[model samples]
Target: MLTIDNVSLKGINRPRLSNVGLSLDSGKLIGLIGPNGAGKSSLLKAIAGVEAASGKLLWNRQSLSAMNDNERANTLSYMAQDDTPQWDLTIEDIIDIGLLKKRLSRSERQRRVETTSETLNLSEFTGHSIQRLSRGELQRVLLARALVSEPELLLCDEPTNALDIYHQLNVLQLLKKQSEQGRLVMMAIHDIPQAAEYCDELVLLDKGRLVCHGQPFEVLTKENLAATFGIHADWICNKRGVAWQPRPL
Candidate 1:
């Protein structure tokens, strides 16, 4: 289980996060939902142990701040929002960067690299330089990097921002499957309907403060929508999934 207690971070113009607390466990897909500067990224970084902040971030009852770089890397995988490597690294080579260097055996490392590539449908492009791939493809490769690490906790920022409709759905479905297999995943996302459908819980943030958190049906109310985002949306739900269709301008 992961426990967050009164976490806070200082930002450039204002405070990034303030007094945020939550508890999460395995086999759950959690969505961090907020506006552009809602401290979503900072919160993710703090949880991943990349950002220093007040309060406590604990995983399995252990303090995250106490872990070293290597220990944190093995415990959680973080995919930043602007995740693009400038080097002309091939898909497979880029993936190998996420492996736990000292822990995995040579064979185990190779297996993980291959498996992650295939899972993200990048096997055919293994040898292609990341610079040669389109934006959507590169995003997939980045996600592959996070998955290759096989960390117990996966934290991603705006993972669907670069994808087409099909790939967006594909990636979220894959994450759902990962959660079912008894791991934990937390993703920063803008799409409310999708988050409602796939996430076991939704955390709503507004200006560095947590407004509310609960199941999709409870958190995505019209009042919360207007309070968080200055717009109204029509709700849609069916066998396919839940979605909020914003009223046209």
Candidate 2:
């Protein structure tokens, strides 16, 4: 389990996060939903040890702040919203970087890279430079790097921002599978209906505070849609799937 107690981050004008608290469990896919500047990325960074926030983040009863760099890297993997490679590294090189800290032998490393590449549909682009691929392909490469290690906790920010509709759903399904395998997968995604359908729980944030946290039906109510997203919408859930239909304004 991940325990977040009174986590807060300072900003130049106002606070980025204020006393945000949540107790998340493993084997669940959690969606971090919020509007722009709602501190969704900040909260993920705090939990991933990328941002210096004042709070107690305990991973499975152990404090994340006390863990060293290598220790934290082994425990969790973070995928940023904007991960552009400066150098034109090949897809194989980029994916191999995820296993740099692992003590796996040569054959094991190759096995991991091959498996991850195939899973993300990147096997054909092994030797291709990242600069030559499309935005969506690059996004998959970044996701492959995050998944190659198979960390216990995965934190991703806007992971599907650059993907097509098909790839977006495919990746979300993959994330759901990751959680089903006993890993905690938390992602900041903009697709409300998809998040509602796939995620086991949703953590809603607004104005740097946690508005609500629960199942999709509980958190994505009419009031929350209006207050957080400034819209009037009706949430529909049935055998087909989940959808938030926006009413005519």
Candidate 3:
């Protein structure tokens, strides 16, 4: 389990995150949902140990702040909201960067890269330069980078921002699969209905505070929707899982 205790970040004029606490478990896909400045990115950065915050981010009772760079890299993988490649490297080259910290042989590294590439359906573009790929394709490559390492905890910030509908669903299903395989997956997602459908738990944030965290049916209520998102929404459960419909207020 990951325990976040009183996690707060000081902003220029206000707190980016304020006394946020959550205990997230493995084997579940959790969605962090909120408006534009809801502190979703800040919280993910804090938990990833990239942004310093005043609180304890403990994984399995171990404090993340105390872990060294290598240890932290091995323990968790972080995918930023927007990552622009500095070098126009090949897809395989970029994916292989995730394995740099591991003590794997050349053959093992190649095998892992091949496996991850196939998983993300990027095998055909393995030799292609990432600079030439579309935004959606680049998103998949970044996600593949975060997944090739196979860390215990995965933190993704808006992993599907630039993807088409098919790729968005594909990525969410892959994240769900990762959680089902005993990895803790927490992603900042913008699609409310997708979050309601795929995530086992939802963390609702508004104005830098955690509004609620629970199952989708429990957290995405009509009241919460109106309060946080400033809209009227409803959810229904049927054969296709939870479906959310939004109505203008």
Candidate 4:
């Protein structure tokens, strides 16, 4: 389990995240949702140790801060909002980098790279330079790199930002599978309907404060939605199930 206790981050004179706390268990997909300036990215950054914060973030009873760089990287894999590769490395080469510390043979490394590339439908572009790929293609390649490491905890911020609807569902389904296989998957998402469909738990934030944390139905109420987003939604349920259709503010 991942436990966040009384975590807070102050920016200049403003508080970006204040007294935030939440616990995430394996086999659960958590969705972090909020309006602009809600500090969703800040919270993920704090958990990934990319930013400093007060209080504690513990993984499986161990202090995250105490872990060395390699230890933390081995257990946690984070995918930033923008995953475009900086250099002109080939897709295969970038994927191979994910296996940095592994003592695999040449054949093993090649096989892993091939498998990951195929999983993300990057086989055709495996030999091409990452810089030559489209925005969505680059996103998938980066996600493949993260998956190749096989970390126990996966944290993604707006992973489906550049992908089309089909790829968006594909990525979310993959994350769901990971969580079901006893890995913790936490994602910051703007798509509320996708969150309702894929996430097992939801954490709603407003201006750096935690507004609600619980099941999807409980946290995605009409009142809560209005309060957080300042928009009215007509929530409906049919044979296909629950969905929220937004109305004019």
TM values, all candidates: 0.95, 0.97, 0.97, 0.95
lDDT of 3 at 168: 88
lDDT of 2 by residue, 25-132 (tens): 999999999899999999999999888999899999999999987888799998989889888899988988888888899999999999999988888897999999
Candidate 2 residues lying further than 4 Å off, grouped into runs, are: 247-249
lDDT of 3 by residue, 1-249 (tens): 999999999888889999999999999999999988999999999999888999899999999999998898899999998888889899999999999898899999999999999998898896899988999899999999999999999999999999998888889999999999999999999988889889999999998999999998888888888998888976677887666778778
- Window of ten residues with lowest summed lDDT in model 2: 240-249
TM accuracy, model 4: 0.95
Off by over 4 Å in 3: none
Error of 4 at 45 (Å): 0.8
31 Cα displacement, candidate 2 (Å): 0.1
* Model 4 per-residue lDDT tens digits across residues 1-249: 999999999987678999999888888999999998898999999999999999999999999999998898789888888956689899999888878866779999899899888888889885899889899999998888878878899999988989998989899999999999999999999999889889999999998999999999899988999999998997776678557889757
At residue 99, give the lDDT of candidate 3. 90
Whole-model Cα lDDT of every candidate shown, in order: 0.89, 0.92, 0.93, 0.89
Each candidate's number of clashing pairs is 0, 0, 0, 0
| Residue-by-residue lDDT tens digits, candidate 1, 1-249 | 899999999988889998999988888999999988998899998988777899999999999999888888888888888777989889988999998554878898889999999998889897999989998999999999998887889999988988999989989999988888888999999988889888999999999999988888888888888888877888889897676677633
Ordered by lDDT, highest first, the candidates read: 3, 2, 4, 1
